[model samples]
Target chain A: MKSREKEISKIEEVLIRFHRRHETFQAPPFWTERLMARVRGEKMRGNGFYRAGAVVWRFASVTCLAAVLLALYASGLNVETPYEIVELMFDDPAGLDLALLFASL
Target chain B: MAHSDKETQDFEIIARIMGGDVNAFELLVERYRPLIFGIVMKHVPYDRVEDVAQESFLEIFRSLGSYAAKSPFSHWLSKITVRCCYDFWRQHRNNPEQVLSSLTEDSQQWVDTMLAGRSRDAFEREASGREAREILNHAMARLSAEDRMVLTLVHLDGRSVREASDLLGWSQISVKVRAHRSRGKLRKVISGLLDGRQESI
Candidate 1:
């Protein structure tokens, strides 16, 4: 038992020494440059994806907005000014009355 | 005080990186490369250290946004490095035989000495540092990814169970259990190697 303990202690010591010995490595002078270059490349690739997604989203949003405008034009609901829309909303007495009731409540 | 100051500086660097100053990232990589490389070398094969270290840096960069700063940035980076090492082993689990067969002549000799049950003094006198590291690496390669990560962090790197638990995002009990199991597995691998050497003799 004593011998086994001694052997284990020796193994532990050797392993610890080994671990400490290998702890620090001299990184090459070009390491930072190489890593930065890779990071830049990755950023560019990521930007490509982001740009593509932005294009798609912008296209979808514009398409939706154009479609809504076309639908409103087809329905003859186009108003030239904000006042006209406000006048149209107030033209409904029931909505005005409901708004007044809610305001009071 | 120094710790918080470093943390604040890291946060500033992170902010700059997030604000589209991509060049600021070079500072982070420069600061942490040695640390990441050291952690990686504990598990990565010698030739593949650079590749794995680079992969860890890229991974850190990609995942930087998710860092919440609840823990120290270094601890979080250590976790990522450990995970990359685990992934390296997972990707190569089936190739252990190939790896073992590629051990250098010096490592093989060291293994033979270990198998002979040489005394500690004899090992100290005879085994070169490279041989000792290679022997440990060989034994480590045979372990499971979890075992390798836990053993490297807790045993080889001299981290406490709590620290390892924090880094691994595992419970303290889980870290303790894994550490125990990993140590057992490592001992078994070493013993098996010694036995194989004896039989070959």
Candidate 2:
């Protein structure tokens, strides 16, 4: 048992020394620059996707709004007062009649 | 006091990076490059150390937002570096022949002496520092990536099993079992190398 312990100790010492010897490494001066450039490239690529998505979303939103207005106009609804049309489209006509009756009174 | 100061500084830098200040990340890279490179060098071949180290940093940066700062930044960085090394070995695991053929002449001699069971004193006196490193590296290359990682962390780096478990995301018992098995495998490899060398002699 004692001999085994001694062997283990010797191995541990050797390993510790070996580990310490490798604690310092010399990286090139431009390593940080290269890494930064790569990171920036990654960021730009990510932003490209984000910007493309934003543009698509904006275009789709505008197109949808325009389509809705075109449909309302084509249906012979008033295009100048779009909210009134929207209210008439969505609200109960009885509610609108009641609101108009109140306004008249 | 010093530890907390470092933690605070790391937190500040991390916040800046997450806030989209790209330049702030350079400070982190400069501060930890040696540490990351040193750990990476232990697991990878010398020729590939730079590439592996860079990959590790890139991984760390990409995952920067997920860093909880619950542990020291160095510890968290080390976990990423170790995983990078593991990934490297996984990609190159089939190329054991390449690793064996890359050893220097001096390292080959040192391995012969170690296999012969020479006294530690003799090894210390006779082996060049570079040769010692090479022999260890060669021995490590013979083991699986998991074995190399567990042995280096638990035995060589003197990390506790709990620390290793946390770093590896393994149960403590699992780490202990793997560590024991890895040490035995390392010793067996050394003995086998010595036997092969003796036959060649």
Candidate 3:
């Protein structure tokens, strides 16, 4: 059994060496152009999806920013506290009453 | 090109591609096509080499946004290319039509000559024949895709366990264990062949 293992190991090394001696292949002529055309086609297909996604993201971001800026502008941007900003953004009547009470205090 | 300069250029090209100049990708493909082909050729069937390499490059381009640049670009590229070859084998692993090439008489002679303990130089000279490739491929076909990848990376490619693990995204222990088992499997396959040839005599 031990001798068998040794023989296998020897053969494995030889075989690996043999395998390594195989010449490295060069890319066939004009293969890069063929590959590039495929890449460009794939990117074109992908860009449609990406462009739609970008539009959605841009719209969401602009709407959010515009809403925030409009609120700050309408409230005079002088609402110093986060509580005031939240009050401007939401209709929590009880919280509004609490803020009024705090202001009076 | 200097190594650092090449890396800088690769990063510059990657940045340009990410910045919406997709045409900049041609530079990268041109630079690494040889490296990618060399790797893919070793891992995939000869006929599928171009297909697999093309797929690898597309994958690299798609995932360019995720590259963090901590590791060298070439190492990352190698990992992706190797993974593409692995995927190729995985996809084909279940095909019923996958046939092992028969070992030829010349391959049998090559094996006999190898086992007969000729000098190292003589062995090296004769081992480059097409028969040796056929015999190796015959045995390698029996291994699972994972085992085949590990054996090729470690045994045939002469990569260390650490390097193989990095390239394979496998734990070192897994790579080490798989390498040993795959080698044993290969040995058994070859041994069976040798025994069969002897019985036929």
Most accurate candidate by DockQ: 3
The Cα local distance difference test for each model comes to: 0.75, 0.74, 0.84
Writing each residue's lDDT as its tens digit, candidate 1 over B16-92 gives: 98777889998898778778988887778777888899899999998898999877899899899888888888888
TM-score, per-candidate, Cα-based: 0.70, 0.70, 0.81
Question: What DockQ does each candidate score versus the true complex, computed on alpha carbons?
Answer: 0.28, 0.25, 0.43
lDDT of 1 by residue, A3-105 (tens): 4445444555576667756446667678778888999898888778878998999899878975665445434656667677566556755665335534654
* TM-score for predicted model 2 compared with the true structure: 0.70
Query: Candidate 3, which CAPRI tier?
Result: acceptable
Residues A1-105, candidate 3, lDDT per residue (tens digit)? 776667667767777887676567767788878878887888888889899999999899888976665564546647777787676658654556445534654
Ranking by DockQ: 3, 1, 2
Worst 10 residues of 1 chain B by lDDT: B96-105
C-alpha RMSD for every candidate: 8.1, 7.9, 6.6
Q: Rank the candidates by TM-score, best first.
A: 3, 1, 2
- Listed per prediction, chain B TM-scores read 0.79, 0.81, 0.93
Candidate 2 lDDT by residue in tens digits, B1-201:
246876888889999988889789999987887789888876677778889999999899888978976778999999999888888887877875555634565655765554457776875654436766665776687777788888988977788999988887879998899899988876665555445555667
Query: How many backbone clashes does every candidate have?
Result: 0, 0, 0
The sequence of per-residue lDDT tens digits that candidate 3 reaches over residues B66-182 is 898888898899999999999999998988888876777877777777778889788787677677778888998899999999999998999999999999899999999999999
Question: Order of all candidates by lDDT, from best down to worst?
Answer: 3, 1, 2
